[model samples]
Target: MNGHFPWLTVMAAVPFAGALAVAVLPAAKRTLAKNLALLVTLVELVLAIIVTVKFSPDGDRFQMTESYAWIKSFGVHWSLGVDGIGVVLILLTAVLMPILILASWHDADGPQVRMDGTAGESAAPRSTHAFFALMLAVEAMVVVSFAATDVFVFYIFFEAMLIPMYFLIGGFGGAQRSYAAVKFLLYNLLGGLVMLAAVVGLYVTTADHDLAGPGQGTFDLARIAQAVSTGELHISPGAEKAMFLGFMFAFAIKAPLWPFHTWLPDTMTEATPGVAVLVTAMVDKVGTFAMLRFCLELFPNASKTFAPLVITLAVIGIIYGALLAVGQTDIKRLIAYTSISHFGFIIMGIFALTSQGHSGATLYMVNHGFSTAALLLIAGFMITRRGSKTIADFGGVQKVAPVLAGTFLVAGLATLSLPGLAPFVSEFLVLVGTFSRYQAAGIVATVGIILAALYVLVLYQRTMTGPVKAGVEKMRDLNVRELVVVAPLLALLLVLGVYPKPILDVVNPAVDDTLSQVEKTDPKPAHPIQAPVEQAAAVTPLGGNK
Candidate 1:
């Protein structure tokens, strides 16, 4: 797969090319731009499926790899590859793009006037071409980030993605969109700066150790990780810990873990639902994925050293986010808080240092993407119809729009990790995995589940169950297009929930490899189980046992 064809490059290039084409289309050709973008995404989806089918889970750790020299001076290369984890995430990105494009068809068509009769600075009629183009650009960057095997290549796209997302939020969002956009940019830029220092530090360390050659340095992730694992590239414990902190700081902000998470709710609250989904479901995932790919593999000793602290932060975020969600009155903000909690579970699982934890964290990323997309997109539709983001603005929505309410309920249930929904299986694995290693943290995290049910059911009851509010009388059911968006997401949630083996089969081997890189093994039980014959003998009377 590596030498045969440039599969990963083509996968990323198609969307990038489509974005440029869409961006340059004339204003009058909005429909043409939209359709072109959708077609590009669909093609990307097909390519992703082909890659997945061709990827052998039992085969090499990284398949479909492509590499070329880009910056030979610093030992940089234009490299790309995919393991099971990368393939699934790429698939997730592809599946969401066209659907989000459809959901956002009219989002940029006109200005959004405020209640005060004044359109804000950002409320001018936006270019529909730019909106869809930015989305495609985001898809391109995210896909590249997932497939990139070069540390420098990953860093470039990881930071480059902010440009499109900033425009998506500020240029096409709510009254306070500018503030949200700036906050989002500044927060991420700060993290990227810290990570830049770490990236430089890593190259310096490699040069000092002469891992690549007598004097050359390398930014190839696989090459460096191999050296680290074989003990050929020895970084001092203190330096490794510092570099790990630098990388972890950026990822935590991107993961938007607590203390660093203040930016997410505001960004989600201000941006359109589709853009919000891109941020949380797609962009943010690169953070946690990098934790597995870079932090653990490249600095195994440091990863183990920091696992306890990271898990503690994760537990706090879980309870903290759920508690805040219970109190939010804005529908979008509430959902944003819930994402923080879900991310907490993901981070916890990753640091739990077991195969189950790693697999669950990986699967949770995919499941959360679909579940959050379904919920946020449906909420966007509701907000559009009602002209309010406040939860109290609508009541008995089910009375007039039964289908919308029903679907909303389903999405909400999935968010709370209800059984038979995609998120449940992942959340259960996170807990089971965490409990096996860190029992107290796992117990505290379960409180998030209880709090999750509280917020979701309360949100539903208040908005859907009461008598119809004054302005809700003319509300309509989900039209054909809206149903198209919601139906597949709901179907995936159901199908994945009942049978997660397909995803697990792909993820487990990768998990094992990660554990091996970190030199971790699952802990043995304190109380060992007796053999079948021993148990039978113990249960039988002395004479009857013979």
Candidate 2:
């Protein structure tokens, strides 16, 4: 927490070190690489916990902040900090990494089963070393992206995440791995390019100001936001809105809103379970997070102008994703579509522009990660065992693997936001907050809950219930190691469901700060009026009172 310790820098570096080590290790030392990566992630998790403890609930300023001049000529600095929301997300990034690594124990080092039922014949047999190394690299980039306080720094960290993940899909994914990876890469790259233009525009605008004087501009996010919040910085309204759209366009693509979401299912379907969980559950969150941090905070006026369109899209995504999920035969692809549906809810919560909605969206991020992890990992277990990822390939799995079926049921229930589960609390908050502002959108999004139930339960019933399928009679239940792997995630889902106050305490303050930054409030209802009979009659100018 202290500047003296530089924990933020250290935390980000640990995974990089692990990745470099794994990258250099001999091909035979796959165990060493995996173990080292695990050790590094464990350490990162501890540091994330410590960082969380250091953050005060009442504080609005970024905590554990560090700053130093890095590129002096460009006016860029190495700056990082964690607000309550950032810390929780950083914790999520760290927590999910180890769980993913553990779950990928056997899968990472083996050939992935493609859509056609053939094991991928990559240049190498299963290479755990490369897999773990890339995983660690992805973790490092994600951490910095969450913590970055410099605009250019944040953008760089933001785009840097794509490298390790690109290889993760292309090198160790399904039969169509290369295509999926290319699609994911190209989409993200386009978003980044637009954002880069915006970043450059911001610098130029800042430099032209009298305060900046001459040619000195800065890429400090804090300073820029502060300038905008006060009356000092003045870009033309048109320019500001344009810049806002430029940045928003990037996040929208990243958020994979509506038509932008096509690449996600393909990429997720082609990815391994670990990769899918990392990208969809954790990494994709950056989109929403940046929208809150950058789009709303830096462009309050533009956010107001675009709120209606964004909410409309969020509603569309909610329904579209759910309907697609319902029709999916591929289980992994189904998981991807389900996420798109859930993300709609998350986006709606954010733009709802209510404190309750903002806080709920934040909590939804954490809850969705845990829920998705359970679904993906457990489903992966079944697919790996059955030699297929198709839902039709599974039936009556509970008859053979009762424990697995039961766990899947719990995960499915959580996904649908069943009462007494973590997602229910967050999803409820999102709905309540959204309804507080936009009644019609809230009502429409509510239908997604029912669609969610139908998809989740139907998937469960089709795959886990009924008579045992011909080749699946001998499918094994979750073993002891598997239980160990999932127990923590399940426990979290339950504990947070019952006791979300601890997280809310942290998230609420950040939400309040965000609402303050945007400076918008829910519309007030008109007061009902009652008048004397004579006064009422006088008011009826058009016709005489009966």
**Candidate 2: residue pairs that collide:** none
lDDT of each: 0.93, 0.88
Cα lDDT tens digits for candidate 1, 353-434? 9888899999999999999999999999999898898999989999999999999999999999999999999999999999
Clashing pairs in 1: none
Using TM-score as the measure, the top candidate is 1
Candidate 1's error at 330, in angstroms? 0.2
> Worst lDDT window (10 residues) for model 2?
115-124
TM-score for each predicted model, relative to the true structure:
0.97, 0.94
Please provide, for model 2 over 211-279, each residue's C-alpha lDDT reduced to its tens digit, 9 standing for 90 to 100: 345778888877878788886777788988888988988888787788789889999998889899999
Runs in model 1 deviating more than 4 A are 112-123, 536-546
